[model samples]
Target: MEDLSIQHVHLELSENLEAHRTQGFSNANALVVRRGAPFRVSVQLKGRPFNPTTDYLRIRVSLGRLYVLMPVTFSRRAPSSRWSAHIDPTTSNKQTLFISICAPASSPVGSYRVQLSVFTQDRQRSAANGSFILLCNPWCSEDEVYIPFEDQREEYVQSDSGLLFKGTPMNLVSRPWSFDQYEPGVLEACLNLLQVSPQHKRNRTKDYRNRCDPVYISRVVSAMINCEDDRGVLKGNWSNDYKQGVSPSKWTGSGDILKQWAQSGFSPVKYGQCWVFAAVMCTVMRVLGVPCRVVSNFNSAHDTNDNLVIEEYYSETGQKMNLSKDSIWNFHVWVECWMSRRDLGSEMDGWQVLDPTPQERSGGVFCCGPAPVKAIRSRRIDLLYDVPFVYAEVNADVHTIILGQGQVVGFSKDTEKVGSLICTKAVGFPRLQNITGDYKFIKGPTSTISSMSSTMSEDSTTSRGSSKGVLVSLSLDKSPVAGEPIRFMVKVMNKQSVTKRLKVHVNAQAKEYNHSPSDTFWENHAVLQLAPMEVTVLRNQILPAQFEHVDEDILINLAAVLEDMSSHERFLASEEFNITSPELIVQVAEESIVPNKDHAATVSFTNPFPHPVSGVLTVTGAGLIHGKTQFRMSTLRPGGRIEQNVTFNPSMAGVKMLQASLSLSDRNIVIRGFTMVHINRV
Candidate 1:
């Protein structure tokens, strides 16, 4: 007899086996069987050690041409073991079970290997590893073998749920992947795939907010703008060729018709044609789910040209279309979109003309020629579409058309029935031609007044008297130092006229350190003049004192006070010019020294001028003691003096070279009566 001992037996299950069992046998067990023999296999389950009351088992054996396996079920109340009788024993304690087999008498005989598998709700086992084999008669005919081929017509079996395919599936051919190939349904499929996983679903909200594909509406709007110069010829023609066949369902009545045309490849120019084109394009964009509007202005100037130009178009008959150019007749048009608001807030409300014409008369029109075969001449105005115009002042009668949610549709020198209109009051513009006058000092409460004449038009008038009696008093809460902020208040009251507006320009100039003998003081200027009779506070930091032992002058220059104009042709004072001190000078004193310990000395400083003196009194020299170096002082008056004690320590016992100096502004002045001392150490 051959050795039949089983070695390395391993039992595994798909899920927890013990938790689902309550009877005579645990699901985690291996089965032993013999080849070429029929055997009855039975299993009896025993309850867990703690609960031994239940003992049950069930085993079934069947022989058929085909095999169908179902999950094993358990009933806890049943206590007896179930049995099936279908086993054939060929040797001592050696038997096998004929699970399923289909073979004819004519089949060729050979040893056949078969795999027998058993499955429960949570477990599965197979016996194919050197455990099972079948032997057939050597004289069996080949006709007994059943093998299927591709020649049979295959049909899918349909149930209440869905179609099912039979037979083994073949591998599909490979191709390159493309995102564009994904259909609308693919998006839903992707969403479903993402949701199937719990972890992915948990992060879905965050991913949607951060990684969601943003719609680039600007690209679509850019395509519709169509700023080509050739389409400018279609301005105002309103022909079918110039109009885009947009469905009314897409566009609202308030939309610009010309914007629609331009977006649909109609208008292509900046002047009249471009305006009309932009209007149509805007309308078309609105129809395409993009809300848009139009804007119009008169005497508009282009930044490039710095002048205003009229927008005109040539007819198909080679005749020029004349547009009104009078103050009331000049016009311009531009289109804007709501998407701009998403990117640019309130500024997006303004219209951006597709092809903007130059607003200046000196600027020429942008020329455009048709293709060689078309033989057409045209011009396009290239204007920035997204620029914002915060303020607009008109001096003539002008008409503006607003379309598509308050978008300006048309700007015309000529009034249209549906457009907004505004009229400007006629007034002469201001100009400065000549300002060549001499300054003269006068005594008394008023400074000298010079007669000034202007070449403004006779109809022009001036009001508000000069600020001749204005007085500016400067005070400091605390004395100012170099690199510190100084506060000042300017006061003006006495005025020749009260009705006129006043504007003042104030500047301060001082002598720079190390200035050449011929070089005057450098003047730093600042202007402050918005309201009259109101005190204006000014703050500034002072530069470091650059010169020592010398007088420095601070000069304040007040420019001419301009007054607001009235109905009559005359000049009046807006405020009085009562500046108390136009210039202030202060004298810095020389340094004097007193002897101290170990060749150290104390230096005193005084200010000769009545005004307070502010500066750093630093003492620097070679072989000076550490921590005895620099000192800062402020507000030294005419009779007040500040003393600073400094010590010098020589490293070696010998005469040490020492030099004391003071830095004021950028100039360095040496202190007198200081000598090198010889140190003798015993």
Candidate 2:
């Protein structure tokens, strides 16, 4: 094959339901459908209509190497149109052809090559040659899941989120992770993850069970894709690569991760966190004919027990203690699989939650979920697998244990924060759909949260305590760069009338974020005296070595211990900061360039990491190299310097923005830079 071209075919469920449209112009693009369903498509042709040699036009559908041709058939008021031997346009000149593909009820979901044109024994011409994805609809078979055309373009094929690396995951509903699933590497890796190799199979039936069994397949993929098992493809050691200069905070797509895994002789892809694990799992599930979407739960809880209560111990000085297994992550990413739980009743069907992050064990295995979110929200712990654990993640109550000298002091109850902003991509669109209300129902037989609760201790319930006399808080700087001094602030206010003498101790620890808390990495202490109702702010700086631990990944945990010396009462506050490396500095040869004049953009950076890394620098903006340019990069040794120069000419004059990023081959690491220049008219 010398070349290939892709064209988009605007598809809709019906003329009335025009809101549902699907099209793609790359191998990475596809029109998704469910197998054995009334999947109909109206093909609207782009470009000029070709004169047909014959009276009848035919559609040649190719699956693998096999090809079958069917004549373009549809009922119109005029019967002559279907009977005509040459199905070319009449004088009226209509280019649109209506195609109703009748796939059997049990047709295997996959991709197919469809060519719509007028063909004869002597020759054949191409009108529309494109591919489509057949997804498994285990529910009622009528395609309830509607995928928008924009989603097919950006959400399915484009993997990077609009937000840059180290951006907060809190406001991610505004950003989309366009996952390009059709990439060759991603497709291959997905197929390879199945137990039965695709090459060894005779046809679709060879491994139908291993391929379509949602429960079994999900479990195998959840474990096998993460190196929790020796047979897994990727090792999910989070702290290893994340906090270090490596590991892009957000994943680009599945292809890069898949490519890296293959290069390592199938050794596990290194150091994936929850989002990385979830994104890869989404690709695998989608490629395997299972419809999947990545979901982000802000303030998601990790309930250690079946109980939904999350308890936290804190020193009277406001320092949070790390004693409970119950905790809430700022945000958690997991995948929701669309499939019928045939094993369960009709009520349990649809949208099964499958977490590939390996947070907790299910059935003595490192895999979790296939547990129905409906079951979890409905408080149906009676259902199979891990419903209770997932319920607590969304509905756990927070109990803050305040203690002085290792004994419990006054307690604070916080119901805010955990399990809010539960969202997923809306159907038939590329925006967020908040289904938080789906989990907000009160607990009962009708109570989803309470019924899912197997046990509730006294600590589980609490009435928030009254405010303490003084206020003390600890906070880290917005962005702390590695190899530099990190700054933090301690704010204290003595609201009482009398003077206050406060003993303040601030400790900075390097913690392995994805796992249990590690030992303290550094410490600082100071005592202060303040006048009545005085509000004082103290700023402190920690040396680079203090928070930089030997672990490949690190999180700076700052704890502030405040003591009222006169009363001997204490309060505690803490904050966590993810240390980001310095930005990749972009230096342009000149600040101004005339039209048609070439200018150089030198993207320079030093590898702050210990190992050698290879990557590509991509430059893109409105008027640069047809709007995009990619330059391959060589590997750089530890602490090596890279000053890549890319030259581009300004065809038009104005202010132009240049966006460049140094992205590693596997895309585990990415450093971004941007520059704007005035383009002088020649």
Candidate 3:
């Protein structure tokens, strides 16, 4: 087949031949060729001609996967001229190697370039170039070239054994000399065969003529055999010890043993020749009371020649065979078990494989290595599990698991501590719990005592001085209004003991309200202080006022904190009130007026209420000014009046009507009247 050149060529040679050649020839050249084609390639060699006796040349080709090295022996006479090599047509042509790349036939057709090198051993020099392409058959059907085996046949059969196979059992037979089956005493025999003469038992299948033990064959057959009769197989009751209570009579076979193990707490472990280990593990688990069975004839990469090749060895008979690496023929094996109600539907149920000896060294339990369980600690107690006895030394009053090493895999259902106390106070503060009681106070003679007494006498002899406890009272005339000042008075006297070093601090809350008119005038204020037993009156303190037009309610609030000067302890008091304008009552002072043409007319208004008056005034029915007239009056004194006037020129003839009215601040109130006047048109 001719190649359709399509691949790119990359140069990787060391020497530049095109520069040294002088015969109108260039060494820097490129070539493109398709795979599987006979082609000729030529290149000029630098240096003297006809030195072939000692010098040798060779070509190397690398098409990604295909590598070919060809030695070229040029005639000793023709060294200076262009050297050429023709690839042979045959598959075994030394100069032209055949490459049967086994890629999926469905692989996309494209061009792939490879590198070509020319080297001289004596000179230790080399030069290289390459090109490549692949043309796929457009008429080829994908199904015809890459048909899936599942769609072709329900199952496959071994031609030599006449046994039906579904998966990869036949593939194992292809390497007949490496693996085989055992007949009667399959379990014990396979075990003995594996242990005593592992090499001999392994080579039993080297020759097709050798008869495999029926017992070993039976074991293989057992993998395919399903347990219809639950006779000896343990169905459920995973907690039951099959070894003691349920004897071997309860198990169908070694497969049943594996199934039991799965029901308990076992899972599959995979490695090289995993099936062999799985089978052995199933038998071991069955003997250990776990119900299990094997799933046979499964294809797995673990059973391939890669593993077998590494495990290959010679027997005493001088025959070659793979050891346990080819343990389970081509067929894979797994165990399925019927879990008890406790484990049913749990992760422990279903099919599981046993741990196998590691094909390579590992660092964990169940393998040929150390246990990973290093240390353990209890949540409520410090219990060391790795050491001899399980004892707890330091018990955590709190329900917590603290481990020095390892992790908490499980926990017990119990509590140890009820409550915990955290210290939040500053470092200098004393840490104490549950405090209660009262303290006594004493003063030195240096402290001065002030005494004031009030006396009341009836008609009689002079009243004797009576010792009585002094009563002090504090009171305010009214709660402070926001934006307005507050007046306060305090009275103090000597009680059982002369009260000394007493000071009152009044701190008012400065607050603001939005949207609501209530408390709109409250402002935050600083703290105020008062002397002991001192009568003091304070007034006219202005508070800030924040007003929002949206809400019609007024808000007023005040807060004060009183502190004892001696103890530095303080007490707080607050007062709140509201400031609101009653629904506004507005009226116009003047109603109507009859003024001579061109004379100014005046209007007057009387506000009988205590509020500011504001509105727009208009004159209709007559030719008044073009724009409207507006008036504003400050919060009028009760029964106050305001006046205004408008002068107009009567230009039209006939009887003209003059209507004038006062706009009231209240939308519901309007004082209006009309007046008629005879006018001549100007």
Candidate 4:
């Protein structure tokens, strides 16, 4: 009986990983496979062929003290929720037995030990020992993270490079991001995120068991992305003060951030905003085998008090005042992970919103969602995981009020402005896809702005009210460009037949994309006389010098306030716009890019500002370059052009992007550009 033992075991690592759609994780140097899928291992018998009646083979998989044993069977049966093992009839020989093992779809995702035991008449002998790392399976139908669409699964779970939509809806900027899940030490960092979690520290057994559900894992990831409550991955900063750490806008990929975090003994990496937090979380989720995508919500509201109304105040002179805790960002970025929600039933089993930004606390922790998108569309606010907070983000109402002498003079309610657009990167493409309908039902065209009199109470004003005897609208002739004056026209019409005397005050303020505006940088006040039933257009211009010295990439808020002298009624119209920055030009001279071959790329830019500018130019690529290549430049005169020649060797064959950014030394501005290079395999 001792002679009938196992000699050696061979794990078909390459073939199994390819079959499991996990070829990208081959760098882990372990048998990395997904759950709910069967992997094969060949066992060579030392003595003779096993007899089914007198001898039996069983497989043991264990994590710590918890273990499961499954007997090898010849008969094939339907898949079940338990561990299963069967012999591959076509590959079995007299001395070599090829066995297939399938861990349940609900198996815990982590490292597990595999042992083969041969049982003879009265004794069991441990024959071979091996190990594997299991991940969530989006390809398995029974798995909670299963996504039906092949293209979607590939884009969400496999693609390493993506685009994060920022700026305003009108001037959308598709910022390139390197998810970098396949980069060195990133996957290990993702696994480390789970190991260092509070749940794992509190109760190891329970944490391991709960990892089987994507919902549980997502909640953990959401909390782990922000350092508000735990020793998480990234520390969120919205104050535009990044003196102690790298600025969030300067991050090109998750690889450096994750590697830095792990190398620093799990210390929180400083300075992440909405997009940075969302992009980093996407990398972690994709590394863990969960399907995830970054989504941008334009005009996203932060309802601090959960009242579903964001109150914004403006002075009588059209200067925006920071009088309320609730505010609306130009755009807010978050992640949506695809999974099945058994707890909420199949109706709620599609895309789930998981925001990692520490905007609001949930259950005493700064994590959000696994809240089903369908549930949000249906207004199911009672669901768990901060659904109400997310619901208010994209569907809240904006109450704009004009305060004069401590009295509300003019008021308006904008129901459509809070969530004008919601989008994500398209599947299998490099463009934006509108997903606004997924969050809220589309409403037909209606007057988004409704103005009211000072006598109307805030609660009594509805979304259908109109201004008394006047109608106002703001319009821009063209998009605002950097180094050029921003010119816009404000049209105010007297609806009534009587003539009206009015005061027209226009205010221009510089603002961060995610926060309220600063003090009024440029404002104009004028008294105008409107003839009976007259239509007048007031033209305004904000010069380039007025905002070039502003901090960071910012937006300009242009607001106009009109007060009727006869009736003392005031109306407001405003436009928020982003000034387009100059882009860097990247040119690769070679026609065909090959791996391990030196390539010359040129990064060229001209001074777009009025004064001389000097800064450091940084170029980064995930798989194309080893690390970032930076060049410091002297002050170039206005309209002066500079070209930098960069040489790098391609590490592997794929489509890679070379991203370049020029951060000005004189001002807080970053000019970015990218060019895709498709490499040929050797």
> Top lDDT: which candidate number?
4
lDDT digits (tens) for residues 339-390 of candidate 1: 2222333332222223222232211233211011001001112222212110
Best by TM-score: 4
Across residues 150-207, which tens digit of lDDT does each residue of candidate 4 receive? Answer: 9888899988888899877777787889898877788889988999999999998999
> Can you tell me which runs of candidate 3 are displaced by over 4 Å?
1-496, 502-504, 510-535, 543-552, 580-682
TM-score of structure candidate 1: 0.18
Q: What is the C-alpha lDDT of each candidate?
A: 0.25, 0.58, 0.27, 0.85
Q: Give the CA lDDT, 0 to 100, for residue 408 in model 2.
A: 70
What candidate 4 gets wrong by more than 4 Å, as runs, is 1-8, 44-56, 94-96, 118-126, 445-468, 588-600, 646-655, 679-682
Looking at model 1, residue 263 earns an lDDT score of 48
Q: What TM-score goes with each of the models?
A: 0.18, 0.61, 0.17, 0.92
Q: Judge candidate 4 against the unseen true structure and give its global Cα lDDT, from 0 to 1.
A: 0.85
In order of lDDT, best first, we have: 4, 2, 3, 1
lDDT of candidate 2 over 1-682, digit per residue (tens): 1111113454443431211121211223345554543444555544445333343456666555545566764332232112111222332233555445544334444456877664433454446676655545433344222233444333332322222122223213232232334443555455556533322243544444234356766777777667775456656655454563236344444566776776666667666777777877877776555567777775678887756778877554444568887776756778877656767876877678888887787777777888887898788888886788778778888776667776775454556546655777664444566666666563333322111111111111233232336676665554566557777678887767889898887776655444344566677788899898898988999876555453323455567767778766666666555556445676779866887777888878787755577888776553443435778879988788988787878655544555576776643445666665567867
Ranking of all candidate structures by their TM-score, best first: 4, 2, 1, 3
